[model samples]
Target: MMINNARHSYVCPNCHSALEFQTKQVVCQNCKNTFPIDEYIPDFLLTNQEDGGEKLKNRASRFDDLSKVYESSNWGGSPRIVVWLLTRKIRYKAGIGLDVACGTGVVARSMAKKINYVYGVDISMGMVQKAFDLSQKNTINNISFARCDSENLPFGDNFFDFVSCSGALHAFPNAEKALKEMQRVLKTGGVLTIMALLQKNIHSVIDPTKRELKKSSTDEEIIEFNKAHSSMENLDVKLHRFTLAELKMITKKIGFNNFKYLKLGSVLIFSVER
Candidate 1:
């Protein structure tokens, strides 16, 4: 697989500066921070303070470990359903697309068929590597993968014609920031589609015992129970289950309009025009 020079599509994820593409690395023109290119995929993952701290790193590590079996795993919901909902409204045939938190590139690859080009980004290197590998093995030339945070995208503002995030919004540490970043990069009137878990019940899915405790315990007891079960917490980052109403409210507040959604079981697939 040859490297497609998509350098013009990226900016410094840290400082939003221009980048100088080299043979094996990309250098930020303003911050002077450098990122490496491995096997034709650029690595734009920030570290320490710039990387959303330790919790985000842990989440990325978790996905990294899951990358090997992610395609065959049930963790990511039905890809065919997700792709259908996401591309239902897309009519453009020659525009740029972005897939955020693109685990294993299912949505990204599907999106590539509708758009002229697509860029798939994920925080986990393992996931990005797998995405790139699959694209290469299948001879997909118009799509590329990068390791970058969703909250701080490595692209310029209003650069994408369509943006889609499927089944991974709830796992983001700050969902609002991620949404805002998606909006920022999207061109005016661009489409944004997202699929996430709907918060239906007050009982915790992470810890089902909380439901039993909530029935008879006081507020203090709930707090105590949380502390005791803290070690059992998976993903470390708080998993936010968003209700449809909440999703509408937040996305509207962030400047997205024409909201529409379809509910399939507990998963909510929604689309909005920018």
Candidate 2:
């Protein structure tokens, strides 16, 4: 199936210049920085040695290692619940959509049927490639994937009609900056939905034990834990689990309005308008 690459607009990460899409690469007319299109997915991340720092690099590497089996694993919770939360409030059926930190294109593929077009972006190349491959296998042509940083998106301001980030916000190096970028790319009055793990009272009691076990457990023990727990709290990574008040404060400070959220088993599914 031929992928439709013309549905969304892209800008250069360096000079923020409009990008010219080619068969094999994407060219920046102003900066002359050409980004290669590998396996039909464009690479929009800039090549700076100190771009994301070590923490970001490690997180990307972890996702890359998990990309192949990401969808098969039970890490993202139930598909029905995710789809319902992502699509229930979508007001426009033919509008453009975006999925940030789209690990394996779960949100992108799910939104494709509802929205006219969807763009999925992630920092890990392996995750992006897996998303593109899955979309091709499913013959879903209305969606596109790219490798990019959520904190610094490659699209122009006020471009998307709907945006979403699922189950990955807590893992970002700078969640606030990423949220600001999401707001910047969303058109005025566009809806922004996010699903993230929040810090709860129960987590205060369980997180410490989990962290200690994760630090001292064997590979087999870790595998057992992974099989038993499907939440982000079980992951062996540095995460900043936001409280309800903290999330509200951050979104309010970012100028998002009509903030509404639903709490489902420690996962917070929230929506705000730009």
Candidate 3:
């Protein structure tokens, strides 16, 4: 709806097939399996595959590195960078906030500083567990991590005053469903903020020879990667991307209004009022 057969769409969450934009097709041509979109979003949480525990566990150090530049991280920032930006837009104190799909509780910790209580939800219990360990090791207590699906959040409506999610949506099979779920649990007029990598024209300075982080021989050698440089393939998990123009149309259909944003960066941030 945002563009004329827009050249971008979500990746198949189940088989990781590239999706067709602006349409409702769940069966992957390559995998020959059928899935469905819940609400306007797709539901990408797969079954019988591996849970994200190991990935989440591994994310501890990486996520911590992310916190250092959450506001300015070029790569590996995912949603933390967006969360950092939104934290500046609204008051977090005296409210309940959710870091949906929190990897290692990085955003959850940031949320706890301003909100009375913060909940970090991810489908991977492994991720949740690591988040807890990292938070504990860092002396963070106000935040709690849980295993929950963003598509089917295990909480009541109007439960949160402000809700924030970054890289989680794109990773889901049905990002649209996850988006609706994020919108569902918030109080009326609550704030909803999201950040995701741009689908078009992404570039980074990091060496492209690896899947995981490569260590530099010296401190100065690491200076070039001072920020985690990311590309479409660099994401711990594959996800969708969007140009600001396309995102605005998608958010409108997802029931987001009063939106504002900053474009032309590796990550795009959007703020809305429910």
RMSD of each: 7.8, 5.1, 13.0
| C-alpha lDDT (0 to 100) for residue 75 of candidate 2 | 35
lDDT of 3 by residue, 1-274 (tens): 2122112333343444554543553555566544444333333444433764344344333434444333232234345455568676556478888888776666777877888777776664445666677777878766665454576664566668888886655556577787787787788889988766676433332344222335423443344344334322354654556667777777789888888887635667778888
lDDT of 1 by residue, 7-58 (tens): 8778999888899989899999999988889878888877637544566667
User: Largest lDDT belongs to which candidate?
Assistant: 1
Kindly report which residue stretches of model 1 are placed more than 4 angstroms away from their true locations once superposed: 48-54, 73-77, 200-233
Q: Largest TM-score belongs to which candidate?
A: 1
Every candidate's lDDT: 0.81, 0.78, 0.59
Off by over 4 Å in 3: 1-83, 200-238
Q: Report backbone clashes per prediction.
A: 0, 0, 12
Candidate 2 displacement at residue 274 in angstroms: 0.4
Once superposed on the true structure, which residue ranges of model 2 sit more than 4 Å away at CA? 1-4, 49-58, 73-78, 200-237
